[model samples]
Target chain A: MLKSINVPRHDRVPSLIPDTQASMTRQEIANNNWEEALTFVALQRDRSAYAELFSYFAPRLKAFGMKMFGNEQQALEMVQDTMLNVWKKAALFDASRGCASTWIFTIARNVRFDMLRKKQSRKDDVSADDLWLNGEYPEQEADTDASQWDTQLLMEKLAPHFASLPPAQREVMERVYLQEKSHQEVSDELAIPLGTVKSRIRLALDRLREALDGARN
Target chain B: MAHAIKFHPGMSLLEQHAEGSLSADVALAVAAHIDLCPHCQQLSRDITADLACQLTQQPVKTNTTDWQHMLNDIMAQPQLSKQAAATQAQLSAQAAEPIIVNQREFVVPRALQRLAANHGKWLHLGGIATAKLPAGNDYHVSLLYISKDTEVPQHTHLGLEMTLVLAGKIVDENGEYKAGDLLINSPDDTHTPRTMADEDCLCLSVLSAPLKFKKGLTRLLNPLQQFFY
Candidate 1:
């Protein structure tokens, strides 16, 4: 059945993935069994292995989607699509090119933004160069202490910080990001005005973004 | 000058963005933030210098042989048909030149512009024109030059659309996006885009799917999308 038709398992089959039970952090996951895991996913129609892969990246992918779509629900959808591709394209994962996290993150990132590009229909704007630039490259690198482990450690260290935030601010963030609510949705959920939700989320995001950045330094 | 939202892009993101290693979505958001804050731009450059120095420390893995070979495999493998290649070429083209906020020519990396320009003659899609590149996939690379006060009609989308502002500013319900801003719209999101009058705006956009027109006679032209894409 595998070779009767010359179709690569990568294409034409989007399988149902079970939940991943891997106990390792992203780095551990990267160092151990990542390549083998990819090989397994690539060759056989394995559901359990794909699930473990999805479990690790899904939350982070959702977080990224939240940032991009500005809402949690949409972010969830984005992560879903990203993980789906990851499950199917596990065969394409190459450790030499980049770490599994970087590869998966790149895919998730592209998928999230791809949706954004679709949202803004490509028509009728005379000079688009104004609002969007094709060439917005940053020459800057993640110049943290190279002697230390990957920056992922820093982000993990910052995870507990969510508990330290002002309850009000954290609530706003949770509603908007964790819960995937819109500004309006968050407000309604909390019985607060829309502006309050917007201000709280904005202030919370600013603080979090700054604090996280500072921690890396 | 019109109450531009001053965005304070943090140091870490600036570092990652300048590194060109951040995920593209984060990069786009960070780009939007950078567009609003010149302070971030200066800092990003400083960080860029720091990153270049730090790069000296990143040694090739001991076991790794030629890194280029792995990259060659990805590059050598074919993606989608004409749709994917053309699309990637268009993206690579826009990425070639970093969109200078106020420059006439697209300020991209030399490598990218060479690729996009390598594609056949561009198809002018009234307002912003497009060219179906020789690359794979349903890639539609286009340019938009909006004279002051022009409003691009409201429209929906099918697949994915990526826009890179090459000049001026365009405002949708989302917010006023200035030069060097990347405004991405998720699928099914619709908005009326208006370009302020006085200054002509230039932009480059990549549309993955055919657009779904919501109003007016423009819908009639939907079937004949080759010219418009």
Candidate 2:
């Protein structure tokens, strides 16, 4: 009989084993040293550190891209562009504001939106083309210390919060929050009244806020 | 402010903005509003962080070949020089200076500042003056300046119309819209916008289609709608 190894939910301690050690799986290494690895790439231009980040995030980004764009080629391009941005903008990442996952996810999200907008512009002659012309604004100062936002702890809390939502509410939450679909689009897709979609999203957000606030307190 | 902005673009619109799904014009309007409103900014940050968390929880599948390719592309890209970055920042900073309209100098919203040079000659129509902004590709973009106590003719939108109050206040059947308030109107909605007697109203109006005049002598302005564009 095999005993399951239980990982601690909010451990900040670094694993004693080196990330490159043969005994450690790729996922284990990534989970253990992502922040350190990202910092190394940022400060030292370490190729190996970048390789670690690329290996872990590129695939995840590709999957996210595919989900957003529904095209394998575009998804691959999105991953490539996003990874390139990470490499270039690594120095700008402030741990105090957000975690590396949040930073990278934002880059992927923005890149996907850019691709979609470009496609839309080519197909239509709409007048609002100059709207997103400016690059992203500077990052705002963090309201609190980074330690207050333990990435692993938040992630652990979030999964259960999301899982606890009713299926109807969760569907709207996922579509709007994760899939980035508009309320009108989601309403049309589900063939439900717009008010129903809005209420479900509101309820889902309220529950998420309650759970996250509870954790904070 | 007589009335607080009773109307907002809804959470879904803000969420789309945070998710980077809104169109550039709408996004610009939203970004300008976010710059002035801290409440919306906090909401935006929360939504972004939540989305990031959701992304992390999803199962990821990718081949080794994809990772290798991504690494290659990242390696091939040249790193931006610190000096170059500093110069770029300086350029943007210089470009953000306020523009003078009539005698009043109003700081352009960062989103609109980039297109400041493209503003056309100020054209006066009754008590309302308009300047066409060359930036919007899909919508008719203009800066409408309404003098104190002036009233715009009652009109309905032929399509979607978005008005973002950049300065002062405008009142309609809905409510009073102050600086940073975004008022969106569709074909079904019709209203006459009037400026308060205390101050002149300045607004950035983006129209997907022309406005249809609904009352009185203004109905004749329908054929002259091209002038508004």
Candidate 3:
């Protein structure tokens, strides 16, 4: 169940890659154009496009699941379930609402939640209504290019922003967001007040907002 | 943006909704609110993307055998025809229309439409009316209607009570709750909810347990609290 990848802990050593190498890698990924790949799967059921998406996202999703669940087998299951949903619900992808990454990420998040709930023996009776609301989709048409560009730019900035977060804020944010733990749970784990836990999360989010807005401007 | 709801669900609730940790009933209420609130919608999107970006950076151990099996499963599934797709879209669009009770019409939030068909019989209680909605797991849900200028007896919840105002205004000690406002009250809260004189108020209330009436005369209704449940 655990196929260990022998990669170095590059997240801890952010400067291992030279600036030029990092930028080139970012450029290459941006050039792959996730939206077009999703469109291919949606319209043509293209195997190669699906394969491309699977190769890119499945591994990352597994990593994300492991971080959240701390179990390799469950993480693999999460990756499998998320990819299955992507294949089954490809046509539901709406570029007008968001980019491919945003859509897929939302799916992965929801899938993880479902798995957690099922593990706790909770009933799953939420109708489709609990998923999306309102007839008016967020109209990104006016600034589609700008927003898409911002999304890509933000993705590139994520690591640096995370690395720069204050230690307390970073720990809370990681526990709350990445590990899928509630603020109350984090407070208990860290032996801090719940209010402190919330404040730390808020401060981290504010820093990210400021940094991302700076990038946009 | 004039007359926008002053009170919204906490950011943590929205975050939970985005993360999928919220119960289905609470999530449905939040989804309905998100449809009505742009600020929340944007926040939810931002959080989702941010989480995704962080996850994308993690180095993953790829299991080739599992990947091959998944690919095979995906390939074997049948695809929907264009006609079927169009029809499904049409049906969902039609489902978005407003729900009518007597002469009053309220635009059902897109997320609540699927549950619209299961709305129970409307039971009149003094100036207010309620109809139980389908139970989702542990919670009992109901659509509550308060006539203009009507006041509900002071009450506190037996367990957690989440009320999402769907239309008009409900005033309590906390604040004026208008459409799209979600008020979460635990056992510690006690308040008398009165509607403004201008228009009738509609709200969806999800309760973890039955509400306990705390005031005079209404306390007699406590024995009949099972009725509300």
- DockQ: which candidate is best? 3
True contacts kept of each: 0.00, 0.26, 0.29
Please tell me what DockQ candidate 1 reaches.
0.03
In the range B87-124, model 1's lDDT, one tens digit per residue, is 54255334343333223455432322433444455444
| C-alpha lDDT values of all predictions | 0.50, 0.67, 0.68
Q: How accurately is candidate 3 docked according to DockQ?
A: 0.17
Candidate 1 lands at a TM-score of 0.37
Task: List candidate 2 segments past 4 Å from native.
Answer: A1-33, A116-217, B1-6, B62-65, B81-95
Clashing pairs in 3: none
Error of 1 at B26 (Å): 11
| Ordering by lDDT | 3, 2, 1
Question: What class would a CAPRI assessor give candidate 3's docking?
Answer: incorrect
The predicted structure with the larger TM-score, 1 or 2, is 2
What lDDT score is found at residue B161 in candidate 2? Answer: 87
Q: Taking the tens digit of each residue's C-alpha lDDT, what string does model 3 give over A11-107?
A: 3222112233344544344334677778888787766777667767777887778778898888888888778778766777765555576677777
For each candidate, report its DockQ versus the true two-chain complex: 0.03, 0.15, 0.17
Query: Which ten contiguous residues of candidate 2 chain B have the minimum total lDDT?
Result: B85-94
